[model samples]
Structure formats: C-alpha cells, structure tokens
Target: MQTIHINRAEEMYDHPPIALAVGFFDGIHLGHLTVISKMIEVAEVNKLKKAVMTFDPHPSVVLNPEKKRTDYLTPLNEKRRIFEKLGVDYLFIVPFTSKFAAMSEKDFIRDYLTDNHVKEVIAGFDFTYGKYGKGNMLKLAEDRDGFNVTTVSKKALNDEKVSTTEIRRMLMDGEVEEANAQLGRPYKISGLVVQGEKRGRTIGFPTANVMPDEDYVMPKLGVYAVTLKQLSTGETFKGVCNIGYKPTFHDPSKSAVSIEVHIFDFHDSIYGERVEVFWHEFLRPEQKFSGIDALIAQINQDKVKAEQILRDMEL
Candidate 1:
C-alpha cells in the first residue's frame, strides 16, 4: 500500500479518485475492518482506488492536551502493515493538531473529503469529525456534495461491540484470549531486548528483558503464554512472559515495570535484539516467593501452565 503523509487535503488532489475508509482505526478490529472492506468493495465497483484516512498523535492527544499520554492499540507502522495485508491501495495519514481540530465541518468536507477526489466516504456508524465533532454520518448523508457516504453498522462478538477501547480494556485486565478473539489475531507488543541482572539464568530459565515501546497499553502484571518472534530472523519460539515490577527480587532502585520472556528450548544471548511477543493466554498473576528455591519451583509450574495453554492453542 502507498502511504501519503498529508498536512492538508490538497496534497491528495493529484491522486486517483478514492473510496476512502476514514477513522482512527487504532486496533483495526473487526468493526474497523468492516468499514475498510466496504471501501474496498466500493472502490472495486466504482473503479476508484481503495484508501484509508487516519490521523496521527490520536485526536484525543490534541483535543485533550491535559491527558498527558494516549496508548494506542496499533501504532502507525502496525496499522500500515495491516492495511497492506487487507489490500488497501492508499493510506493517508493526517497530522492531528489543534489547528486541524478546529476545522469547521463545512470546510473539512469541502477541503478534505471533496477536494481529495473521495467519490465515496466510508466510516463506522459512530465516527465523527470536524470542529467539536459536529460532523456525523447523518449530516454527511444529508450533505449535497457529489460524493456519497457509507456508514458501517456496529460489529459485535458474542453480542458485545468490537472496539479499540474494549480491546485496550481487556489487555489492561490481562484478558488476552478474549481480546485476541475481537482483534482476529493475538495481541502483540514489539521492543528491543535490553540487559538485565541475569537473575533468570541463575534459576535455569534465562530471559530476554524487553523495554517496550512507549504509548502502548501494558498488560496486567502476570505470567502469560506467548510466542516470541525475533524480528531479524523471523524465528518464532514458544515462551512464557512475565510483566511485573519483580517484587520477588526487590530492589528499591528498580521501580519501573519489566517484560521478561523465557523462550522454551532456546538458549542465546539476544541482548539488544528486536522481538515481538504475541500474548496468547494469561497464566497467573505475578507472585512474591519466599525464597530462591520456591521461586524456581513456581516458575516451573508457570512454565507447565504456559505450555499447556500453548498446546491448546496449537501454535
């Protein structure tokens, strides 16, 4: 897919007319995919380019400046990868800033949607745009612009709406399996392995400590069944990941949380290597052990649980 970074819609005027699916598309969940699929269908039927228009920095970051940080389900690069896999022809990334947020509904429609050769605009039913979110599907449908608007109805799983917020909530609660069901894939986080004190090595379960990317939701403190994929080699390994503050080996100076994964049947010094961990199941919460022997025994139990879960998943 071709990515077009634009500060203004005029930048997209030269491209072919497009059937655009516009939204934040954070998780690219089933609901978001419905809109994109419609855009693709519309484009195929109308002979227009299949396109997606999303924003950067997230609208909440600009609209609610005091919020400090906004965690995303899929970062820009990940979104691009998913879009490409879904067969999108164009991906337009617009910078979300205070000025852009202040654009009037009429001006946004005229300058952004209409001027960019958007023959048909597709979005989720709840999607809103323009200053103060004054633009809605009803208003867009009522507009006399030459382009048409398509609003995909809410998509659900087990009677609950599939949404990025819900997925984030599940991850925060360590409900990986349910979140993956809604996401249509395992929830993944990528980061480079960093050096640690080699505490795991002493226990016969050497781990690669990962320093995760900022602004991505961290799962609840727990041991989880996961698949660790080394980005450089594309080699995947079954693993058990622990997300915690490591209370078992307390150090007052180490207050930050850590993500350490112990890959089964693997032994390598992978410090500084990039890897992506796909969370499959939540095994148990992080626990403080009485001593080194107890900690090792509990880790062995956690490994058994993780292995069973991984076996059930057939991954």
Candidate 2:
C-alpha cells in the first residue's frame, strides 16, 4: 500500500476515484474490520481505488491537553502492514496537529476527501470528525457534493460492543486472550532486544531483554505465553515472557518494567535484534519471590503453563 501523508499532499496524487475507509483505527480490531470490509466491497463494485484514511498522534494527543498518556495498539508502521495485507491501494495518514483540529467539517471533506477524489467513504456509526468532532456520520453524508457515505453499525459480541477502550482494559487487566478475541487475532508488539542485567542466565533460563520500538500500550505486569519472531531471520519461537520490574531482585517501585522473554531450548546473543512478541495468554501476576531459588522454581512452572498454552494456540 502507498502511504500518503495528507498534510503533505500534492496535486501529483491525481488518480481515479477511491473508496476510503476513514478512522484512526488504533487497534484495527474486529469492529474496524467491519467497516473496512464494506469499503472494499464498495470499491470493487464501483471500480474505485481502495484506500484507508487515518490520523497520526491520535486526536486525544492534540485535543485533550491534560491526557498525558499516548499509547497505541497499532502504531503507524504496523497499521500500514495490515493495510497492505488487506490489499488496500492507498493508506492516507493525516497529521493531527492543533491547527488541523481547528478546521471545520466542510473544509475537511472538501480539502481531504473531495480533493483526493474520494467518491465513497465508509466509517463506523460512531465516527466523527472536524473541530471537536462536531461532524457525525449523518452530517458527513449531507452536503455531499462529490461523495457518498456508508456507516457500518456497531459490531458487538455477547451484546457488548467491540471497542478499543474495552480491549485496552482487558490488556491492562492481563486478559490478553479476551483482548485477542475482540481483535480477531493475538495481540502483538514489536521491540528491539537490548542488553540487560543478565540475571536470567545465572538462573539457567537465559532471556532476551526487549525494548519496545513504539509507544505501545503495555499489558499488566505479569508473565504471558507468547511467540517471539526475529524480523531478520523470520524465525519464531514459543516462549514465556515476563513484563515486570524483577521484584525478586530489586524494588518494584524504583525499577522500570522490563520485558524479558525466555526462548524455549535456545541460547544465542541477540542483542540489537528486532523482534515481534505475540501475547497469547496471561500466566500469572509478577510477584516478589523470597529468593533466587524460589524465582527459578516459579519460572519453571510458568514455562510449563506457557508451553501448554502455545501448543494449544499453535500460532
């Protein structure tokens, strides 16, 4: 997919009319798929180019000054990967700057959609845009001089709405399985293996210290059944990951949370290697063990549970 930064758009982008799915698409969860599927259908039927329009930095980053936290389930690069896999022809990313947020709904439609030859736009029922999100799906269809709009109704499971907020809550509560259910896939994150205190090797369980590549929403402090993939080699391994402060060795309040993954039956120096970690299941909360021996024993148990979970998942 060709990633286009709308804020830096030029007239050279002239092309055939496109059917665009518009949203921030933070997680690209099942709810988002509902809309994108419709967009794909429309684009194919009308012989229009397939495209997705999203925003960067998230609106909350610019609109809500007091909301300091900026975590994303799917960062821009990851989002682009998904779009390309979905066969989207174009991926439009609009910058969510203070100046851009102040624009009116009409100006946004004319400047971004119409100017880019967006003939059909698809979005969820709750999608809104323009200054302070004053534009709703209903309003978006009105004054449509050059485009038509389709609104996909709320997607839900078990009578509960499938939303990013709920998914984030599940991850924060260490309910990765449940979050994956909402996302229609396992929750994955990308990071680079960095050098650490090298304590795991002493305990007979060597680990790769992972430092995240983007501002991702971290799950609860605990152990998880995961699969780690080395980007360059494309080799994936089943593992048990501990995202904690190593409370058994240091003060939890003082140490920052670290990502330590023990690749089953493997040993190699992978520092500086880029990898992806797919969270499959939550094993247990991080706790302060009494001693090194106690920690090692618990880790052994964690490995047993993690291996079983990964074997069952087979992903």
- Candidate 1 similarity to native, TM-score: 0.95
Candidate 1 lDDT over residue span 1-315, tens digit each: 889999767887888889999999998988888898899999999999999999998888888788634777888888888899999989999999899999998888998888888899999999888899998999989983879998899999999999998998899898999999999899888888999989999879999899876456788888999999898898888989999888878762667888999999898888889889999999998888889999889889989988888875554
Q: In model 1, which range of ten residues has the least summed lDDT? A: 64-73
- Worst ten in a row by lDDT for model 2: 6-15
Where model 2 places Cα greater than 4 Å from the true spot, the runs are 8-12
Q: TM-score of every model? A: 0.95, 0.96
Q: What is the C-alpha lDDT of each candidate?
A: 0.88, 0.90
Candidate 2 lDDT tens digits, 148-251: 99999999987889999999999999999899999999999999999999989988999999999888899999999999999999999999999989888888
lDDT of 1: 0.88
- Cα lDDT for residue 245, model 2? 92
